[model samples]
Target chain A: MYPRAFDYLVPRTREEALEVLAERGSEVKVLAGGQSLIPMMKLRFASPTTLVDINRLPGLDAIDAVNGHVRIQALVRHNDIIRSDVVRAENHLMTSTAPWVADPLVRNRGTVCGSVAHHDPEGDWASVMLALGAEVVAESRDGGTRVIPIEDFLVDMFTTALEPTELLTEIRVPRYERGGGNYQKLERKVGDYATVGVATHLELDEAGVITKAGIALTSVYVRNLKVTEAEALLVGRAPSAELFGEAAAIAAAACDPTSDIRGSAEYKRNIVRVFTERSLAESASIAQGS
Target chain B: MEINVTVNGTPHTADVEPRMLLVDFIRSTIGLTGTHIGCDTTSCGVCTVLVDGTPMKTCTMFAVQADGRSLTTVEGLKRNGELHPIQAAFKEAHGLQCGFCTPAMMLVGSALIEENPDPSEEEVRWAISGNLCRCTGYMNIVKAIQLAAQNSTTGGTAE
Candidate 1:
């Protein structure tokens, strides 16, 4: 099926794109990569009157690392993020999770920001970003900018708290203090959406005891959720398989999974438990190696 | 709007509607039927093509977006009246049957080999995961890519 007819605007700059979005308001959808938006449009799920194409906008395609933080542009495709040297060094979780997104062809066109904006509950990046304490930089046409924490960015299933006139411009992630992060996802097939996924970021003190633990679970809730209880259980404890299992149990109990084509709600909940354990264990290895 | 693009090494400029998809432009306007459209949904890689050395789903792109870019389709892979190594390997290995998916398979396969000279069986399988084969000739298709990677003339083996 074809999408409804709509006016297409290819803006050359971020300012021009914002102006178009502000002028069109809810009637316009910003097209970046089009891996997510176009498919939804073709399926008649999204019928915006205008599409503001931002692929040509200058300076929105960079991966910069400075001040122990990595700033990624909204237009950075998944493949480019995986190939980025800065992401490999500063945020290895992004590098590890990006390759498992769909496949090479989809990754070549899907952007990290686009996936976040699309707000698919099953998307891998959302949970990873949340666990890493990433900040989303959004700009509106009124020259106002707001930094939305990943925890508050997502409102519900396939919904974000972004305004119609707002454009997602950048994603900022701070470097971990001591340990590293890891993402674990379970998919039914090679390129299908995840049934359940977990992202864990752990930092240990010099004494080899866990100082900070951040955990986020996805595909098992309305949106990516931060499991504070699971994280609290990890603080001040040594990394152990049994401790990770307890934390994973807390994470699984914290989620409210829904039944879909992927699996039953109970099945997804079980997978979330397994993935959380795996992610924590993997993060611990990176922690100990450092 | 005036849209100009180099398709299969030949440049063409046409006045296309602002909403014209690149795949439609190549297939309908340019008459290069070698590029097939499987699912308009962009989920299938049947509309795959190379845009300035990078593989992209043509159906997901606008003809205007490709105005200044170079596009390589299945029709462009032949050189000096000889089939490209991917095409040669496919022919020798019988990598196709009904042939509807041949163009897209070759386009994605060739692009994968171009980016990764030597690809493992799993890597090659994952590279074309976006393309679905109803005839299920995947075994021979994998063999074709392996043979192509082995030939030093095709491109130096990657890994």
Candidate 2:
């Protein structure tokens, strides 16, 4: 399949990128990694008049710890995240989730920020970022930048809060105190998208009481489902099989899964419930230092 | 747009359309057809090539995006008319039957061995997970990669 013809612009600096966006914002698509956009273009689902290739832009690919947040530049590939010692040390969930994405070859070119910006309902990054309470940094042509919470940034399926002139530059995930986190996805095959995916983060006090909890789901709804009700159920509670089961049920009820080829709605909901229980159990065990 | 890329130790500069995919550029423009296009979508890695020594699906990337970069295709895996160890192992172990996915499988296997010289059987499987094969059932493919890992003293690269 061949994508429609378009003008390609390679910006050497961040300011140049923003300037191009400012001028051709509506017609131009910012190509970062091109893992998702190129495919969409080939499928003719997207046909931008111009593609602002930002791959040459310097200083936008660093993974750094800034002011208690692990800041991943927009160009940080999934393979980079998978290999980054900083990511593994600060957020183990990202490490676990990175491999579940397409595959090793695709991961070498797919960017974490690109995945977040694409905002696919079945993408794992949005749910992972939601579970980590991550923030997205967007810069516009006016030399102004804004940080958006993951919840606000991911508005709906294939949609985000970013304006046409805005370029998503970085993603910042808070470096919380060491905690236990896990991402579980039920895909039909190795490289398939998730039928139902769950990401869990748990913080525990020394006495083994849950101090904080994040439970997010993917592929069961139009957007990343953060089950705050289930999260609340886990807080102030000790790790137990019964508690995990209860929270899983709450999370499953919150999902709006649709019947499709992957499975029926009821079956998907059951998978969600079961995966939630299993992931929470694993996360809780890791949290309890077992 | 004109792109200057080095493929298989040879530098080539050509004028190409912005939407021209790297796979098309390699096959049509540069006249190297070893990299097969199984699925234009990124799902199938039969179009996999080494961009800057990392395996990438060429069909999913634009030729303009690969400007001023280095690429390695399956055609580059041989030296002095002799097959590279990975290729030899694949032939000896019968890694491929239909041969549509062999080039990508060999390139991906080369990349895997280059990164981890002693990759286990499970690691080999994971490395080639993206490249799909309808024939051979992947048993011989895995064995070929393991055989290459054992036979090659240095990394699986032909210079």
Candidate 3:
């Protein structure tokens, strides 16, 4: 199906794109990889009046480690993250989650920033970003740039803290000194959204005790569910199956999933509990190895 | 509204509406109908094409987005009337039954072999995971891709 008629703006630079966004506001949509936005437009679920194509804008595709964070630019595609040795080294959750974002075809064109900015609760990137304590960067013609914590950035389903006048330029994931992470997703088939997704990050100190922990859920809540209660419970403790099971129980209780064709609500919550425990166990092993 | 795209080694410039999808532009405007559109919502990868050598779903991408870019459709797999290795291997392995998804399957398979000359069966399956084939139960297709990968001496896209 063809999308509704709209004006297409090929912005040659970041400044030009921001100018159009600042002026057109909600009317103009920023087209990054077009993996999600274009499909939504074709379905008429989202029909913006104009699209500011940012693909031509140079220098927004780099993935770099800067200031103790890995900055993924606006144009960094999902496949780019999958192939990045830096991401593999710096953020294990991101690298582990990269291959599972859609498929190889979609990953070639879908941007990490676009997926995170789109903020679909079913999207795996946001949960991973949340698990890594990622930051979002927005820019406009008038306002310079604002850094938003991932928690505040994702306000609701397909909704974000971003103003209509602003464009999401980048996402910054903190570079941990020693951590291991894993993303466990349950999908019926390839290219399907996650039924129950769990992203776990465990950072251990020199003594192998947990220094920091991050656990987030996907497709189980109104938004990406960051299990702060579970995270807190693991921070002062060491990696153990029993401790992970306790945290997993808290995560299962925290999630709000409704019954659908995927499974009954009870089954989904059980999967959440099981997946949380499994992912945390895997993450702890990797952390101990590191 | 004019976009310049190189398809199948030929540069074509056209003035198209912004809503025109790349699949439509290739089939309708460029007159290359080998790339079929199965599910326009990007579910079935029958409309898969190479945008600057990376496989992407053309049905979800706009023609304007292909401006100043290169695309490789199924038609590009053949060079000088010779069938691409993947195409020949598909025939030998009986990889196709209905032939509705043949063009895309060949294109994706050829592209995968180009990237990894010796792709494992799992890698080949993962590479074509976006594409859905209702025929052959994917066993013969996997064999076809492995056949093509083993037979090719040089990394060939036949482009």
Candidate 4:
């Protein structure tokens, strides 16, 4: 189905796109790769008066290493991030999660920032970004750019801390000291959304005791669920299969899995418990190897 | 808007609506019926085409956005009335039945072989998973990709 008639603006610069966004505010929608927005528009869920095409916007599709951490532009495509040498080397979790996003064709059009801004609870990037302690950079018409931690950025399901007049500029991931991470998602088919997804990061010391851990679960609630209790359980403890199982149980208990045709709430919870344990154990092994 | 793009090696300029999709522009404006539009959403890769070198879903892209870019549709695969290796392989392998999804399947398969000449059966399946064929001839399609990869001699011998 064709989307409703709208004025299209192909802005060559971020300044131009922001200017249009500032003036039009909620009446205007930013088009990154049109992966999410177009589908929504066609379905009449979103009927904007103007479309600000920012594909040509400068400095929005780059990946760089700065401040000892990897920085990615919000407009970077999924395939681009997956293929970036610096991102793959420095952030293996993000690298691993990128390929599982959708099929290759979807990755060619989906943008990292767009996904974050769209803020779908079932989206793979949100939980992975949350697990990595990623930060978001947003610019408003008031000439101020704010940095928001991923924790605070995701306010709830389908919502963010971003103002209507603000446009996301980039996402900043902090430099981790010594951590190996893994992302595992359970899907029914090739392009279907996750039924239960887990992203885990484990940092161990020479003694193989967990120094730090981050666990984020998605597609189980209104937003990406952070298993804080699970992280606390593993901290300062030896990364063991039994410990991982206990933490996974805690996380599974924390999730409020919704019922869908993909699976029942009970089934989703079961997978969450099992995958969480497996992912944590796998991440621990990789951490030890590293 | 008047947009300029090179389709199948020929540069053409057309006056069209800003909202016109790339697939519509190619089929309606350029009169190339080789590419089919099965699903407008990016889900079905029936409208797949090479933007620069990577395969993209034409239904999700606007004609205006493709201005000044090099586009290679399925129509460009043939030379001097000779079928591309991928098309020939599909014919030999009986990869297509209904033919609704053939153009897109061929485009994605050809592009996959070009990138990875010796793609495994799993890799080939993953590569064309975006393109759906209701006929359920996926096994033969996979075999056709294997044949094309072997013929390319770029190190892809389907396992």
Candidate 5:
């Protein structure tokens, strides 16, 4: 399949990109990794009038450790995040979850910020960002920026809260000390989108009591599902198999999955339950050592 | 639109439509058919190519996106009229049957061994996870990559 013909604009600077976006607004689509947008265009699911190519823009690809947070620029690809020692050191969940996003080839070009902006229900980065309480920074033509929390950024399937003239510039993920995290996914085959995926992050106090807990589910909801009630159950409580089971049950109950070729709703809920338990157990074991 | 790209060590300039995919540009415009487009849906890695030393699915990227970048396709795997080590290994190991997926397999294998000279069996599987081989069931392909890693003195010379 071929993409529909569209005017392509290469912006060497972020300022140029913002100008193009502001002028074109709803008619323009920002091309970052081109992993998701290209496919949609080829399938004719999306036909934008103009494509503002930001891949050439410099100074937007760094993964830096800033003030108690790891700031990832919009241009930083998935493979870059996987290879970044700073990211791995700060949030091990990202490293473990990135490989599950897509194959190595796709990861070489797919950007985390782009995936988060695309807002696919099965996007691993979206679930991970929710589990980590990440924040997204969007820039506009007027040089104004808004930092939107991950929860507020994702609105619905293949939709985000980003304005028409706004471009995602950076993603800030808070750094946590003595944390243990795991991402568990069940897919039909390698490189396939997740059938059910769970991302869990836990921080233990000096006494091995859960001080912070974040849990999110993917591929089982209209949007990335965060089990805040389950997370609250974990905090201030000691790690135990029974407690993890309860949290897993809560996550399974919270998810609203539709039956498709992958599995039935009940089957996916069961997978979510099992994966959540396994991920929580693994995270708890690591938290004890951390 | 015009694009200047370095493919197979040769810099070429071409006037291509902005919507032209990199795989189509390489095959139809540059006349390098080694990179096959098995599935244009980006799920299949038959069109895998190295862009600036990184393996990328060319079908998902536009020709304009590849402007000013260097790309290495399967046609570049031969050095001085001889098969590259990875290609020779595939030949010796009988890693291919119909030869449809051979080019992408060899290219991805070369890139994988280049990154890790001593990759485990699991690592080899993970490296070529994107590229699919419907004929060989991947047993012989895995062996071919392992043989290439052992016999290769230098990594990924197809540059």
Candidate 6:
């Protein structure tokens, strides 16, 4: 399957790429790792007339923990996250989820930020980002930089609030001194999309009380759903199986999954509840260790 | 667009359409047919090749993306006009039956053994997880990779 002929523009610099995006707007698609775009193009599911390959642009591939945020640049691939000591030291959710993004070959090319931008409901990054309260940094020629929260940035399945003339440049995950995050995914097999995925994050105050909480579900909703009610239920409470169970029940009840080959809606929702509880427990345990 | 790529130590300058996949370029343009395309979609890693020493699914990558980059196809496995340690190990362990996925498997295996001189079975399995062997179960393939890792005195290089 070959993609339709399109003008491939490899811009030399970030400014040049931004200029192209400003000129073409919706007509041009920003090509980062091309792991997702190329496949969609080949399937003819997406047929953008032009593609501005941003791979040649410099300084867009750093994973740095600075200013209380772990800044993951656009070009930082999944394997990069797996190999990054900074990520390992700063964010446990991303570290646990990086190796599970896809198979090794796909990881060698697929970027985490690109995955977040793509915003596929089955994609794992957004749920992790949502659970961590990460922010998306979109850059444009005229608007400068607009940092949109992940919840606002992700509009729907394969949809984002990013303007056509804007490019997603970075994802900033807040750094927590005594925090833990975990990604729980149930897939049919290795390299397959998740049947049900739950990302949970917890930040504890020195007094063993939950100061911040994030819980998001993947492949169980029309979009990656952040369970705000459940998160509200977790904050200010101590880490306990009973507390986590209540939050998990709320999350499962909150998500709307459809019946398909992966499983029945009931089964997926049940898995969501179970995985959410397990991930929260695991995360709480890890946080307690710190 | 014109792409300058070094494949198997030989540089080739060619004009290719932006939509032309790297697998098509290697197999059809450069006439190296060792890299098979089992499933055109990224699912099957049969079209796997080392793009600058990184195993990538050529079917998923554009030929134009290979511009000014080096690639290692299955044809380049022979270092000194002899079989690569991976190839010899595959033969020794009877790793293949139909031999459809051999080239991609060996390339992934060589890359794995290169990084880790001694790999556990789990690691070897994980490294080749992207590849699929339909002819036989992965036991022999895993064993073959582990054997190749041990036989190679200088890590992945047989010589």
Kindly list the interface RMSD, in angstroms, of each predicted candidate in the order they appear.
Answer: 1.7, 0.9, 0.8, 1.3, 0.7, 0.7
Tens-place lDDT digits, model 3, residues B1-159: 888999999999999999999999999999999989998888999998898988888998988889889999888987789888888888888888898888888888988988899999999999989889977458988898888897785555422
| Candidate 1 lDDT score at position A37 | 81
Interface RMSD of 2: 0.9
Greater lDDT among 3 and 4 belongs to 3
lDDT of 4 by residue, A1-290 (tens): 67788888888877777888889898988788788888788778988988888878777888998986688887799999878998877876888799898779989888888888888888988898887888999997676899999989999987999887788888988766667889999988877889899999888887878988889998998999888889988899998778988999998999999888989999999999998998998888777877
What's the CA error at residue B96 for candidate 3, in Å? 0.5
lDDT of 2 at A99: 90
lDDT of 6 by residue, A126-191 (tens): 999999999999999999999999999999999999999999999999999898988998988678
Superposed by TM-score, candidate 3 places the C-alpha of residue A12 at a distance from the truth, in angstroms, of: 0.5
> What DockQ, between 0 and 1, does each candidate earn?
0.62, 0.87, 0.87, 0.64, 0.87, 0.85
Question: Residue pairs in steric clash, candidate 5?
Answer: none
Docking class of 5: high
**Which candidate ranks first by TM-score, i.e. highest?**
6
lDDT score, candidate 1, position A72: 86
TM, every model: 0.95, 0.97, 0.97, 0.95, 0.97, 0.98
Candidate with more favorable, higher TM-score: 2 or 4 = 2
How well docked is model 3, in DockQ terms?
0.87
Model 4, residue pairs in steric clash:
B117-B156, B118-B156
Best by lDDT: 6
Query: Candidates ranked by lDDT, best first?
Result: 6, 5, 2, 3, 4, 1
- Measured with C-alpha atoms, the lDDT of residue A271 in candidate 2 is 93
Instruction: Supply every candidate's count of residue pairs whose N, Cα or C atoms clash at under 3 angstroms.
Output: 2, 0, 0, 2, 0, 0
Across A41-121, the per-residue lDDT of candidate 1 in tens digits comes to 878899988988888889999899876678989889999987898888777678778888876777888899999888888
Specify the poorest-scoring 10-residue window by lDDT in model 1 chain A.
Answer: A187-196
Candidate 5 chain A weakest ten by summed lDDT = A87-96
